[model samples]
Target: MSQTLTSDQKDALQEVTNIAMGQAASTLATILSTFVTISVPRINIPEVSEIGSAISKMVGNGKEVTAVRQSFAGHLRGEAIIIYGQEGCRDLADLMGYDEDIDQSAERELLLDIANVLIGACLNGIADILQTGLTFAPPSIMAERVIINSLIDPTQLTWNNALLVEVNFTLEARNFSCHLVTLMPEDSIERLKQAIDTFMENF
Candidate 1:
Protein backbone atom coordinates (compact mmCIF):
# COMPACT_ATOMS: atom_id res chain seq x y z
CA MET A 1 0.00 0.00 0.00
CA SER A 2 3.08 2.18 0.12
CA GLN A 3 3.20 2.20 -3.69
CA THR A 4 3.41 5.64 -5.27
CA LEU A 5 1.93 6.79 -8.53
CA THR A 6 4.26 8.18 -11.18
CA SER A 7 3.85 11.75 -12.38
CA ASP A 8 1.96 10.53 -15.43
CA GLN A 9 -0.50 8.56 -13.36
CA LYS A 10 -1.06 11.48 -11.03
CA ASP A 11 -1.68 13.81 -13.94
CA ALA A 12 -4.17 11.41 -15.53
CA LEU A 13 -6.04 11.10 -12.24
CA GLN A 14 -6.16 14.85 -11.82
CA GLU A 15 -7.61 15.26 -15.29
CA VAL A 16 -10.33 12.75 -14.53
CA THR A 17 -11.18 14.43 -11.23
CA ASN A 18 -11.28 17.86 -12.81
CA ILE A 19 -13.88 16.79 -15.33
CA ALA A 20 -15.90 14.93 -12.71
CA MET A 21 -15.97 17.84 -10.29
CA GLY A 22 -16.85 20.25 -13.07
CA GLN A 23 -19.92 18.19 -13.87
CA ALA A 24 -20.84 18.08 -10.21
CA ALA A 25 -20.44 21.82 -9.83
CA SER A 26 -22.67 22.45 -12.82
CA THR A 27 -25.39 20.26 -11.37
CA LEU A 28 -25.20 22.08 -8.04
CA ALA A 29 -25.36 25.44 -9.72
CA THR A 30 -28.48 24.45 -11.57
CA ILE A 31 -30.09 23.23 -8.39
CA LEU A 32 -29.24 26.36 -6.43
CA SER A 33 -30.24 28.68 -9.24
CA THR A 34 -26.90 30.41 -8.96
CA PHE A 35 -23.31 30.01 -10.05
CA VAL A 36 -21.04 27.49 -8.36
CA THR A 37 -17.30 27.43 -8.67
CA ILE A 38 -14.84 24.69 -7.81
CA SER A 39 -11.12 24.81 -7.52
CA VAL A 40 -8.95 22.66 -9.73
CA PRO A 41 -8.68 19.12 -8.49
CA ARG A 42 -5.62 18.51 -6.33
CA ILE A 43 -4.25 14.98 -6.12
CA ASN A 44 -1.93 14.10 -3.28
CA ILE A 45 -0.32 10.82 -2.36
CA PRO A 46 0.69 11.02 1.25
CA GLU A 47 1.60 8.63 4.03
CA VAL A 48 -1.28 7.36 6.17
CA SER A 49 -0.26 9.39 9.20
CA GLU A 50 0.35 12.61 7.31
CA ILE A 51 -3.14 12.46 5.87
CA GLY A 52 -4.63 13.96 9.03
CA SER A 53 -2.47 17.06 8.70
CA ALA A 54 -3.54 17.54 5.11
CA ILE A 55 -7.18 17.10 6.05
CA SER A 56 -6.84 19.37 9.03
CA LYS A 57 -5.38 22.17 6.96
CA MET A 58 -8.12 21.77 4.40
CA VAL A 59 -10.78 21.75 7.10
CA GLY A 60 -9.59 25.24 8.05
CA ASN A 61 -7.63 27.33 10.53
CA GLY A 62 -8.69 27.01 14.19
CA LYS A 63 -12.39 27.38 13.48
CA GLU A 64 -15.18 24.93 14.21
CA VAL A 65 -16.27 22.83 11.27
CA THR A 66 -18.96 20.48 10.08
CA ALA A 67 -18.19 17.16 8.39
CA VAL A 68 -20.46 14.85 6.44
CA ARG A 69 -19.24 11.42 5.38
CA GLN A 70 -20.60 8.91 2.92
CA SER A 71 -19.18 5.55 1.90
CA PHE A 72 -19.25 4.04 -1.58
CA ALA A 73 -18.44 0.61 -2.91
CA GLY A 74 -18.08 -0.93 -6.35
CA HIS A 75 -15.13 -0.42 -8.67
CA LEU A 76 -13.98 2.01 -5.98
CA ARG A 77 -14.71 1.84 -2.26
CA GLY A 78 -13.92 4.51 0.28
CA GLU A 79 -15.29 7.55 2.05
CA ALA A 80 -16.26 10.91 0.55
CA ILE A 81 -16.36 13.78 3.02
CA ILE A 82 -17.48 17.41 2.84
CA ILE A 83 -16.15 19.83 5.45
CA TYR A 84 -17.60 23.23 6.22
CA GLY A 85 -16.08 26.08 8.17
CA GLN A 86 -17.75 28.29 10.78
CA GLU A 87 -21.12 29.86 9.94
CA GLY A 88 -21.34 27.32 7.11
CA CYS A 89 -24.70 25.98 8.15
CA ARG A 90 -26.31 29.39 8.35
CA ASP A 91 -24.80 30.61 5.10
CA LEU A 92 -25.85 27.47 3.25
CA ALA A 93 -29.36 27.89 4.56
CA ASP A 94 -29.43 31.48 3.41
CA LEU A 95 -28.15 30.52 -0.02
CA MET A 96 -30.79 27.83 -0.30
CA GLY A 97 -33.49 30.44 0.23
CA TYR A 98 -34.18 29.95 3.88
CA ASP A 99 -35.10 33.55 4.48
CA GLU A 100 -35.91 33.04 8.14
CA ASP A 101 -34.25 31.26 11.03
CA ILE A 102 -33.56 27.59 10.36
CA ASP A 103 -34.38 25.09 13.04
CA GLN A 104 -32.00 22.29 13.96
CA SER A 105 -33.99 19.72 12.01
CA ALA A 106 -34.06 21.94 8.97
CA GLU A 107 -30.34 22.54 9.20
CA ARG A 108 -29.62 18.82 9.42
CA GLU A 109 -31.82 18.17 6.43
CA LEU A 110 -30.07 20.84 4.43
CA LEU A 111 -26.63 19.53 5.28
CA LEU A 112 -27.57 15.96 4.37
CA ASP A 113 -29.01 17.03 1.07
CA ILE A 114 -25.97 19.12 0.27
CA ALA A 115 -23.64 16.25 1.17
CA ASN A 116 -25.63 13.81 -0.93
CA VAL A 117 -25.69 16.12 -3.90
CA LEU A 118 -21.98 16.87 -3.80
CA ILE A 119 -20.76 13.39 -2.95
CA GLY A 120 -23.16 11.52 -5.21
CA ALA A 121 -22.76 13.83 -8.15
CA CYS A 122 -18.97 13.96 -7.93
CA LEU A 123 -18.57 10.22 -7.42
CA ASN A 124 -21.10 9.37 -10.07
CA GLY A 125 -19.37 11.69 -12.48
CA ILE A 126 -16.07 9.98 -11.76
CA ALA A 127 -17.64 6.53 -12.04
CA ASP A 128 -19.25 7.41 -15.32
CA ILE A 129 -15.94 8.56 -16.77
CA LEU A 130 -14.25 5.38 -15.57
CA GLN A 131 -17.09 3.34 -17.12
CA THR A 132 -17.82 1.73 -13.81
CA GLY A 133 -20.71 1.42 -11.36
CA LEU A 134 -20.77 2.50 -7.73
CA THR A 135 -23.24 2.41 -4.85
CA PHE A 136 -23.21 4.88 -1.93
CA ALA A 137 -24.59 4.64 1.55
CA PRO A 138 -26.62 7.48 2.99
CA PRO A 139 -24.42 10.36 4.08
CA SER A 140 -24.22 10.97 7.82
CA ILE A 141 -23.12 13.92 9.90
CA MET A 142 -19.80 12.92 11.38
CA ALA A 143 -19.36 16.12 13.33
CA GLU A 144 -20.90 19.58 13.61
CA ARG A 145 -19.31 22.63 15.19
CA VAL A 146 -16.29 20.54 16.10
CA ILE A 147 -12.62 21.19 15.67
CA ILE A 148 -10.86 19.49 12.80
CA ASN A 149 -8.43 17.69 15.08
CA SER A 150 -11.19 15.42 16.41
CA LEU A 151 -13.02 14.92 13.13
CA ILE A 152 -11.24 11.85 11.72
CA ASP A 153 -9.09 8.95 12.83
CA PRO A 154 -6.48 8.05 10.24
CA THR A 155 -4.98 5.32 12.39
CA GLN A 156 -8.24 3.43 12.56
CA LEU A 157 -8.15 2.88 8.83
CA THR A 158 -6.19 -0.04 7.36
CA TRP A 159 -4.89 1.59 4.22
CA ASN A 160 -1.19 2.44 4.15
CA ASN A 161 -1.48 5.05 1.43
CA ALA A 162 -4.30 7.11 -0.01
CA LEU A 163 -5.09 9.10 -3.10
CA LEU A 164 -6.67 12.25 -1.68
CA VAL A 165 -8.49 14.36 -4.24
CA GLU A 166 -9.62 17.73 -2.93
CA VAL A 167 -12.01 20.10 -4.67
CA ASN A 168 -13.03 23.31 -2.95
CA PHE A 169 -16.52 24.59 -3.71
CA THR A 170 -17.74 28.18 -3.41
CA LEU A 171 -21.29 29.26 -3.87
CA GLU A 172 -21.73 32.39 -5.94
CA ALA A 173 -23.00 35.44 -3.98
CA ARG A 174 -22.34 33.82 -0.64
CA ASN A 175 -19.34 33.87 1.66
CA PHE A 176 -19.44 30.10 2.09
CA SER A 177 -16.86 27.43 1.30
CA CYS A 178 -16.63 23.69 1.63
CA HIS A 179 -13.99 21.06 0.97
CA LEU A 180 -14.75 17.83 -0.84
CA VAL A 181 -12.33 14.99 -0.18
CA THR A 182 -12.30 11.62 -1.91
CA LEU A 183 -10.22 8.99 -0.14
CA MET A 184 -9.53 5.86 -2.15
CA PRO A 185 -7.58 2.92 -0.80
CA GLU A 186 -4.46 1.54 -2.47
CA ASP A 187 -6.34 -1.26 -4.26
CA SER A 188 -8.99 1.21 -5.38
CA ILE A 189 -6.23 3.32 -6.85
CA GLU A 190 -5.06 0.27 -8.82
CA ARG A 191 -8.55 -0.25 -10.17
CA LEU A 192 -8.74 3.42 -11.06
CA LYS A 193 -5.43 3.23 -12.90
CA GLN A 194 -6.64 0.28 -14.90
CA ALA A 195 -9.79 2.12 -15.81
CA ILE A 196 -7.85 5.24 -16.77
CA ASP A 197 -5.46 3.23 -18.92
CA THR A 198 -8.34 1.60 -20.73
CA PHE A 199 -9.99 4.95 -21.25
CA MET A 200 -6.78 6.46 -22.63
CA GLU A 201 -6.29 3.55 -25.00
CA ASN A 202 -9.78 4.01 -26.38
CA PHE A 203 -9.51 7.79 -26.63
Candidate 2:
Protein backbone atom coordinates (compact mmCIF):
# COMPACT_ATOMS: atom_id res chain seq x y z
CA MET A 1 0.00 0.00 0.00
CA SER A 2 1.07 3.54 -0.78
CA GLN A 3 1.02 6.09 2.06
CA THR A 4 0.78 9.71 1.14
CA LEU A 5 0.26 13.07 2.86
CA THR A 6 -1.19 16.30 1.52
CA SER A 7 0.95 19.41 1.08
CA ASP A 8 -0.46 20.96 4.22
CA GLN A 9 0.00 17.79 6.18
CA LYS A 10 3.59 17.47 5.01
CA ASP A 11 4.34 21.04 6.00
CA ALA A 12 2.79 20.53 9.41
CA LEU A 13 4.79 17.37 10.06
CA GLN A 14 7.99 19.08 9.00
CA GLU A 15 7.34 21.95 11.34
CA VAL A 16 6.61 19.59 14.20
CA THR A 17 9.77 17.59 13.50
CA ASN A 18 11.90 20.72 13.37
CA ILE A 19 10.72 21.85 16.77
CA ALA A 20 11.17 18.36 18.23
CA MET A 21 14.65 17.92 16.79
CA GLY A 22 15.75 21.27 18.14
CA GLN A 23 14.78 20.13 21.60
CA ALA A 24 16.73 16.91 21.11
CA ALA A 25 19.78 18.81 19.91
CA SER A 26 19.65 21.12 22.87
CA THR A 27 19.51 18.24 25.31
CA LEU A 28 22.45 16.56 23.60
CA ALA A 29 24.50 19.75 23.66
CA THR A 30 24.07 20.09 27.40
CA ILE A 31 25.28 16.54 27.89
CA LEU A 32 28.24 16.79 25.53
CA SER A 33 29.21 20.32 26.61
CA THR A 34 29.31 21.52 23.02
CA PHE A 35 27.10 23.03 20.37
CA VAL A 36 24.95 20.54 18.49
CA THR A 37 23.96 21.44 14.97
CA ILE A 38 20.90 19.84 13.44
CA SER A 39 19.84 19.55 9.87
CA VAL A 40 16.28 20.33 8.82
CA PRO A 41 14.29 17.17 9.39
CA ARG A 42 13.70 15.30 6.15
CA ILE A 43 10.45 13.33 5.98
CA ASN A 44 9.59 10.55 3.55
CA ILE A 45 7.07 7.77 3.07
CA PRO A 46 8.77 4.92 1.22
CA GLU A 47 7.99 1.34 0.37
CA VAL A 48 9.55 -1.36 2.52
CA SER A 49 11.85 -2.41 -0.29
CA GLU A 50 13.28 1.09 -0.58
CA ILE A 51 13.78 1.81 3.10
CA GLY A 52 17.34 0.58 3.30
CA SER A 53 18.45 2.42 0.19
CA ALA A 54 16.84 5.66 1.31
CA ILE A 55 18.68 5.50 4.66
CA SER A 56 21.92 4.55 2.99
CA LYS A 57 21.63 7.62 0.82
CA MET A 58 21.05 9.79 3.86
CA VAL A 59 24.02 8.52 5.91
CA GLY A 60 26.12 7.52 2.92
CA ASN A 61 27.17 3.99 1.92
CA GLY A 62 30.26 1.85 2.57
CA LYS A 63 31.16 3.55 5.83
CA GLU A 64 31.57 1.43 8.93
CA VAL A 65 29.02 2.54 11.52
CA THR A 66 27.26 1.62 14.73
CA ALA A 67 23.55 2.01 15.42
CA VAL A 68 21.15 1.90 18.34
CA ARG A 69 17.47 0.97 18.20
CA GLN A 70 14.56 2.00 20.41
CA SER A 71 10.82 1.42 20.04
CA PHE A 72 8.05 3.75 21.21
CA ALA A 73 4.36 2.98 21.62
CA GLY A 74 1.06 4.63 22.59
CA HIS A 75 -0.63 7.49 20.74
CA LEU A 76 2.48 7.28 18.50
CA ARG A 77 4.17 3.96 17.84
CA GLY A 78 7.35 3.22 15.90
CA GLU A 79 11.06 2.46 16.01
CA ALA A 80 13.94 4.92 16.16
CA ILE A 81 17.35 4.02 14.73
CA ILE A 82 20.41 6.15 15.42
CA ILE A 83 23.39 5.63 13.13
CA TYR A 84 26.87 6.84 14.08
CA GLY A 85 29.96 6.66 11.97
CA GLN A 86 33.08 4.97 13.33
CA GLU A 87 34.90 8.26 13.68
CA GLY A 88 31.88 9.77 15.30
CA CYS A 89 31.89 7.05 17.92
CA ARG A 90 35.52 7.69 18.76
CA ASP A 91 34.90 11.39 18.98
CA LEU A 92 31.95 10.84 21.26
CA ALA A 93 33.98 8.59 23.51
CA ASP A 94 36.67 11.20 23.85
CA LEU A 95 34.19 13.95 24.50
CA MET A 96 32.46 11.89 27.16
CA GLY A 97 35.82 11.25 28.88
CA TYR A 98 35.99 7.60 27.86
CA ASP A 99 39.34 8.08 26.15
CA GLU A 100 41.20 5.80 28.54
CA ASP A 101 40.49 2.07 28.57
CA ILE A 102 37.63 2.45 26.16
CA ASP A 103 36.80 -1.09 25.09
CA GLN A 104 34.09 -2.47 22.83
CA SER A 105 31.54 -2.62 25.61
CA ALA A 106 32.29 0.94 26.67
CA GLU A 107 31.81 2.17 23.11
CA ARG A 108 28.49 0.40 22.87
CA GLU A 109 27.41 2.03 26.09
CA LEU A 110 28.30 5.43 24.73
CA LEU A 111 26.25 4.86 21.58
CA LEU A 112 23.26 3.78 23.60
CA ASP A 113 23.52 6.82 25.83
CA ILE A 114 23.54 9.16 22.87
CA ALA A 115 20.59 7.33 21.30
CA ASN A 116 18.54 7.50 24.44
CA VAL A 117 19.01 11.22 24.80
CA LEU A 118 18.21 12.06 21.20
CA ILE A 119 15.34 9.65 20.64
CA GLY A 120 13.66 10.28 23.95
CA ALA A 121 13.88 14.04 23.78
CA CYS A 122 12.82 14.27 20.15
CA LEU A 123 9.87 11.85 20.34
CA ASN A 124 8.70 13.32 23.64
CA GLY A 125 8.73 16.77 22.11
CA ILE A 126 6.57 15.56 19.26
CA ALA A 127 4.18 13.77 21.58
CA ASP A 128 3.82 16.81 23.83
CA ILE A 129 3.16 19.08 20.85
CA LEU A 130 0.54 16.68 19.48
CA GLN A 131 -1.04 16.33 22.95
CA THR A 132 -0.35 12.62 23.18
CA GLY A 133 1.78 10.20 25.20
CA LEU A 134 4.51 7.70 24.19
CA THR A 135 6.33 4.99 26.08
CA PHE A 136 9.81 3.94 24.89
CA ALA A 137 11.52 0.62 25.27
CA PRO A 138 15.12 0.73 26.47
CA PRO A 139 17.60 1.55 23.77
CA SER A 140 19.83 -1.25 22.51
CA ILE A 141 22.63 -1.72 20.09
CA MET A 142 21.32 -2.59 16.63
CA ALA A 143 24.59 -2.93 14.73
CA GLU A 144 28.30 -2.41 15.38
CA ARG A 145 31.10 -1.71 12.91
CA VAL A 146 28.93 -2.39 9.86
CA ILE A 147 28.32 -0.51 6.66
CA ILE A 148 25.28 1.73 6.56
CA ASN A 149 23.64 -0.25 3.73
CA SER A 150 23.73 -3.43 5.80
CA LEU A 151 22.32 -1.79 8.92
CA ILE A 152 18.79 -2.97 8.19
CA ASP A 153 17.14 -5.63 6.06
CA PRO A 154 14.00 -4.11 4.63
CA THR A 155 12.76 -7.42 3.22
CA GLN A 156 12.25 -8.67 6.75
CA LEU A 157 9.95 -5.81 7.70
CA THR A 158 6.25 -6.60 8.21
CA TRP A 159 4.99 -3.32 6.84
CA ASN A 160 4.83 -2.50 3.13
CA ASN A 161 5.26 1.23 3.68
CA ALA A 162 6.40 3.56 6.45
CA LEU A 163 6.57 7.21 7.32
CA LEU A 164 10.22 8.10 7.91
CA VAL A 165 11.52 11.19 9.66
CA GLU A 166 15.26 11.68 9.26
CA VAL A 167 17.37 14.18 11.17
CA ASN A 168 21.13 14.56 11.56
CA PHE A 169 23.00 15.81 14.62
CA THR A 170 26.55 16.99 14.29
CA LEU A 171 29.22 18.40 16.58
CA GLU A 172 31.48 19.84 13.93
CA ALA A 173 34.24 20.81 16.33
CA ARG A 174 34.38 17.31 17.75
CA ASN A 175 33.84 15.54 14.44
CA PHE A 176 30.82 13.75 15.90
CA SER A 177 27.71 13.10 13.82
CA CYS A 178 24.72 10.79 13.81
CA HIS A 179 21.39 10.31 12.07
CA LEU A 180 18.15 9.75 13.96
CA VAL A 181 15.62 7.97 11.74
CA THR A 182 12.10 7.30 13.02
CA LEU A 183 9.86 4.83 11.18
CA MET A 184 6.15 4.82 11.87
CA PRO A 185 4.10 2.04 10.34
CA GLU A 186 1.08 2.61 8.11
CA ASP A 187 -1.51 2.56 10.88
CA SER A 188 0.48 5.00 12.97
CA ILE A 189 0.85 7.23 9.94
CA GLU A 190 -2.93 7.57 9.71
CA ARG A 191 -3.10 8.36 13.41
CA LEU A 192 -0.33 10.91 13.07
CA LYS A 193 -2.17 12.61 10.24
CA GLN A 194 -5.24 12.97 12.41
CA ALA A 195 -3.14 14.38 15.23
CA ILE A 196 -1.52 16.86 12.91
CA ASP A 197 -4.92 17.89 11.61
CA THR A 198 -6.10 18.48 15.13
CA PHE A 199 -3.02 20.58 15.82
CA MET A 200 -3.64 22.67 12.72
CA GLU A 201 -7.26 23.20 13.64
CA ASN A 202 -6.26 24.68 16.96
CA PHE A 203 -3.86 27.11 15.25
The global C-alpha lDDT for each of the candidates, from Candidate 1 onward, is: 0.77, 0.80
lDDT of 1 by residue, 1-39 (tens): 565667777787788778877777887788777888888
Superposition TM-score, candidate 2 onto the true structure: 0.88
* Candidate with the greatest TM-score versus the true structure: 2
Clashing residue pairs for model 2: none
Error of 1 at 197 (Å): 3.2
TM-scores, all models, native as reference: 0.86, 0.88
Clashes of each: 0, 0
Q: lDDT for model 1, please.
A: 0.77
Off by over 4 Å in 2: none
